[model samples]
Target: MTFFDEMKTTFKDIPRPEGEISTLEFLEASESLVKLFDLFGSSAFSVVQNDMKGNINKVSTKFLSDPINCNTLQKLILLEIKENGKKVATQGLLWLCRGLQFTANAMRKCIDNKDWELSKCFEKSYSETLTKYHSMLIRPVFKLAMKACPYRKDLFVKLGDDLNKVNEQLEDWVAGLEEIVDVIMKFFESGNYGKGL
Candidate 1:
């Protein structure tokens, strides 16, 4: 099976919610995000702002409901990134991070409003998606990006720090990423990656 087929088999199996934004929708959005990353493989990683916004909107709206405006949530994430985001040679990286932030925010909103089933479904799909990302997507891209830039920028750290100023839901997300950061730091400390940048 193809990668997308595998992704669909894994994520689309998630039990559906009662809204437009189903677990399948989120999974599709994640798959789209990975497609955006694939552009990097062809050295075509630039993003036109309008297209980026449209793509994010398309994904965010999949299961949207009252008080859960995908556009607003996406805008909030972009705003945070614009205010405190860093520059990377690849624009897909920024989009990927922002998309994940938006997904996390949407799930948090579900959890906050006591939509237990949908929230739990989102958590399951997201966890699986992230696992695929780390193993199938991020590792190769990270190696390539590190080679081209040779400097690692923790977008999550910068994002978490900024989001902390205005959003509380990210506390756990940031904490999780920070733990990952600690491991990366240890890897760097081992001098296997040629000193910290």
Candidate 2:
């Protein structure tokens, strides 16, 4: 299928078959999915001015607002669009982001509800998506950002060190969520997701 076709195929609102993993790999994979989702979802909190909300709020009042599809995510994503992607139409990217954001929401729901049973299917699909995204999206964007962005070596200069700081903070927050997913996945893969299971 063409890239556009693949993109269209990815973001359907189909509900995944949710259930616990009978294998250890299932648990680890589940965690990987959640981690990837958080990493991607975090863009909303980092780039968008008003969007923020994650479990990190369990501690402080930092990212309690919803940042889904806010300005920041749109800006960088737009800035990083490729030539082939350029002709894909604006709605294409919007759909892509919405689809990704929707997946992120599902991962977050699993985390919030502590639904280990359904997490198994989520783990498998999520890991695959992350791998595909890294190859097709994230890696390409970084390469383009470093070489293609007009700022080049000086991109961070005008943005200030605070940009990196914010990015780091976002990473740290998402890392925690990832750790939980990883542990959960590992547990089920090992047949022990719960403290004693």
Candidate 3:
């Protein structure tokens, strides 16, 4: 089976009604997406994986603390704002969305440009999505990871035997991820939750 098929929670399954993303499912799907780094078969990707994991844990902890009030991601951040104004989970969710956007953009590039290498796709996506947020010191590390991407054909082969099927699944998965990131970003923009983040 493909990695997407094996995921416990695919982005396509996550609920986002009225632009409110469900917290538990999004966290679960984020966790599953982090595993995609493993498929790259390069230690350099550990940096990306760890960063995503840390943010996911932050949000998940808050959700577990009060699932009733934090049913939707919007509610989670709103309640956090109301209770403490600390915005720990809010910041974490923001970073997590950025990471997800980076991944989705990279995958979309790969799917859209048949001639492009994995390294090129990842580097281009990183430049557009996460470069500004990363510190100067952190940028080189991520750059190295992008350069360490496995050969496009090799990675695609590992994804599944049928390239067409893999591309189709990846396109749908990336589309779902992009939609989630867009919704969360718009919410953040509306509330200025990302003001100091």
For residues 40-73, write the lDDT of model 2, one tens digit per residue: 3234223211211222121112111222322222
**Model 3 RMSD to the real structure?**
1.0
Decoy 2 TM-score against native: 0.22
Query: Model 2: number of clashes?
Result: 20
Model 3, range 11-94, lDDT digits (tens) per residue? 888987676899999998999999889989999999999999999998999999999999999999899988976888999999
Worst-scoring 10-residue span by lDDT in model 1 = 147-156
Candidate No. with top lDDT: 3
Stretches off by above 4 angstroms in model 2 are 1-89, 119-197
Better of 1 and 2 by TM-score: 2
Tell me each candidate's TM-score: 0.21, 0.22, 0.97
Worst 10 residues of 3 by lDDT: 10-19
Residue 196 lDDT in candidate 2: 20
Candidate 2 lDDT at 178 equals 47
Question: Across residues 66-183, which tens digit of lDDT does each residue of candidate 1 receive?
Answer: 2243223233333334555432211332344444553444345433644344324334534444334355654454334323311112222322344334234334433433333243
Error of 2 at 195 (Å): 48
Ordered list by lDDT, greatest first: 3, 1, 2
Segments in model 1 whose C-alpha atoms lie over 4 Å from true places: 1-89, 115-197
